[model samples]
Target: MPSALLPIIAWDYQFAPNAQKSRNYLYITHTPFKICEQPFLLPRPALLSLGITYRRVPVLSIGKDVFCDNASFLDAMQELLEREGEGRALKRGGADRAFEAWGYRSFWVALASVPAGLVSKELGEDRRELFRRF
Candidate 1:
């Protein structure tokens, strides 16, 4: 079994959706994982140590395999669940395909239309700076 560590920040509009989705999947499947609430506005050196240069939230660490984005995280989770037989339920509801589309394809496409100025306005200085850099 692999361990997933999710860094959750409750107030982040951009991040909360994916984090909540991941958390829900874990709870429904009864996957044992750790959730740590951290400041999204600050520099996360721990993620950097894991070779995640983007320094974003919703990172899933399975041993040495670190998934940095929602798409990768969900993809890996689906693979793991398939091996555990829980994936059948996901397939039955079309959740497996749905989430993959939402996380990997649709999310970014939708987010692309969101004004960067609006996002910058919502973010604190530290996060705004980091977002610009990334």
Candidate 2:
């Protein structure tokens, strides 16, 4: 009999591509997890019901375990990989990985720093929505 997967969920996250790489790996490895998605800047009443009170985005919860920070979350993932044979190859570590992570972290910051005009006059909703649909 297979081990029953401990209901895994990514709490309230909207990450750019590189962070998505880590997520993509979980999917590729066939790890059992669920996405408890929440809208940005909103109270995650769903996560709160699970005993998480950190008030930060992008957490992981399994059984009684809840991880709040990204570093700790990745470290927990590393532990899971050791048991599951996901290894270092899958993780983009070292300088290149650091750069990509930096890029991922900075993406939203850059987007936010952009003038409001860019969001409206520059990238119209129709054009953005069209890109988003794909």
Candidate 3:
């Protein structure tokens, strides 16, 4: 008999491309999952409740396990698919790495290009506080 599949939850901010990337990956891989969008401010209650200290979007929650960071989340998703005999979804090669690098660079560039007037002062402060270490 086959084992039961657990629910997969993706936590991220609305309009986040990284979140969309995860969703698109799941869709392409034919994996069923749900998304939970977080508010664009500090004190993400849901993440805090999940014991997640990382201040970033695109967190994956599979059953009781929480995966933070894109690399780990993709790795976990790939492993899950493999265990279910779905095969690897991501190609491991120089092209894949280049694409990932481009994606990340573009994401930052897009974010930085957002007009200051379009962002609220509170949101700006929250983002600064979140990424102060970096």
Candidate 4:
């Protein structure tokens, strides 16, 4: 069985937002797989072993096939579950479809489109300052 690796990192920061999404997909689809909570920093030997170039969390592994990142991972999951006609969430009118449809637009909008006043109000000055630096 393939294992979904989630890096145990802070959610508020921008780098590894895919862990939560990947975790939710696995749960919703009831995919039988192992969860490997890994460190937030340091190179992941597991990922390197799989020959996945992107050193990021939420990598899905099935034998030699490694789906790196949320988009690819979710797509792989959809294919795997849908091919057998299992995992209704990957079927028509599913939440997974809706979520993938939205993609990163909502995230970027939430961060970028707002006025400085609005962003500061919503995220607090300190967090907004950090984001600004990034």
Candidate 5:
């Protein structure tokens, strides 16, 4: 019997480290939450159900409380833990991973079009190759 919370994720084909972090943070915290994944251009029911003004990745809902925003998710966790004097610490606090963007367009948008892979599959082969370097 785990405490349940709704986690709305932006599941788009484009690969965004920032977006990945949005979902990764939740997994790292080991929080029990129900994931509500959304596709590109925003999904309807989720927006309507949550009354989302700006549909983005990682919308969270607890009972009747609906919260939409990635930057504030961590704050919400801390607030919840404070009620019980508990807190969660990220395990890979010092993990070393890097990203580099050369030229104007980072290419994330281009590679996203490739098929097969989640991000590439969504974005198309021609476009994926164009942004492969980034």
Candidate 6:
């Protein structure tokens, strides 16, 4: 079974770093997939339909199975690669974890540094509501 025949869907906000990370990982592994770009605000109907209430981007859906969060997403991708006999193409370890943590911290810092004037009021309110629990 060729990888392209499988339905791999990645859901994320437009220009999201997490989504970009997923794309890079897939590209490096020669995985063929599609991305469903979403809006920054709420009402993500596709994700809601999948029963994913978590407010985050880079959600990966392979067939009926969905992998949310970076860890699970990477694990699933690795599994897929292994199943396809491409296991040796990429290796995972503590370095990946450290990079993920650093990337997330940097992402937050960059987001925080964005000028208020450059961001719309609705986006600001949306993010505040979404990340209120954090």
Give me the candidate number with maximum lDDT.
6
* Model 4, C-alpha of 85: deviation from truth (Å): 2.2
Clash pairs, candidate 6, are none
Q: Residue 129: error of model 1 in Å?
A: 6.6
User: By TM-score, who's the top model here?
Assistant: 6
Candidates in order, TM-scores: namely 0.58, 0.60, 0.80, 0.54, 0.48, 0.81
The clash number for model 4 is: 0
How would you encode candidate 2's per-residue C-alpha lDDT over 1-134 as one tens digit per residue? 01145666776565634336546655765666777776544356887676666655667665557776556665666676666654532454578658757876787566556565545544344345433421
Query: Please, what is the whole-model Cα lDDT of each candidate in the order they appear?
Result: 0.58, 0.58, 0.74, 0.56, 0.49, 0.75
TM-score-better candidate, 2 vs 5: 2
In model 4, the clashing pairs are: none
> What pairs collide in candidate 5?
112-123, 113-123, 113-124, 114-120, 114-121, 114-124
Better of 1 and 5 by lDDT: 1
Better lDDT candidate (1, 6)? 6
lDDT of 4 by residue, 68-128 (tens): 5666766766766676564444655557557766876677767676565554343453354
What are the RMSD figures for all models against the true structure? 5.8, 7.6, 3.1, 7.3, 7.4, 2.8
What TM-score number comes out for model 6? 0.81
lDDT (tens digit, per residue) of candidate 6 on 1-134? 33565678889975877788877887888777888877677878888886788777878877777877767877876877777784534887779889878887887777666666876777767777554422
What ordering of candidates by lDDT runs from best to worst?
Answer: 6, 3, 2, 1, 4, 5
Query: Which stretches of candidate 3 lie above 4 Å from their native place?
Result: 1-4, 87-92, 130-134
lDDT of 1 by residue, 1-134 (tens): 33344332221223567677777766776677665554555555665565556655676665556666666766777676687664532554657567667565776567557666666644646565543432
What is the alpha-carbon lDDT for the whole of candidate 1?
Answer: 0.58
Model 6 local distance difference test score: 0.75
What candidate 1 gets wrong by more than 4 Å, as runs, is: 1-15, 86-89, 92-124, 127-134
lDDT of 3 by residue, 1-134 (tens): 01136788889885777788888887878777787888766678988886787888888877777877777777787777776674646656668768999988887767766777877777777787544422
Cα lDDT of model 5 by residue, 13-77, tens digit: 23444456555665666666555555554344756665575544455555556556544655555
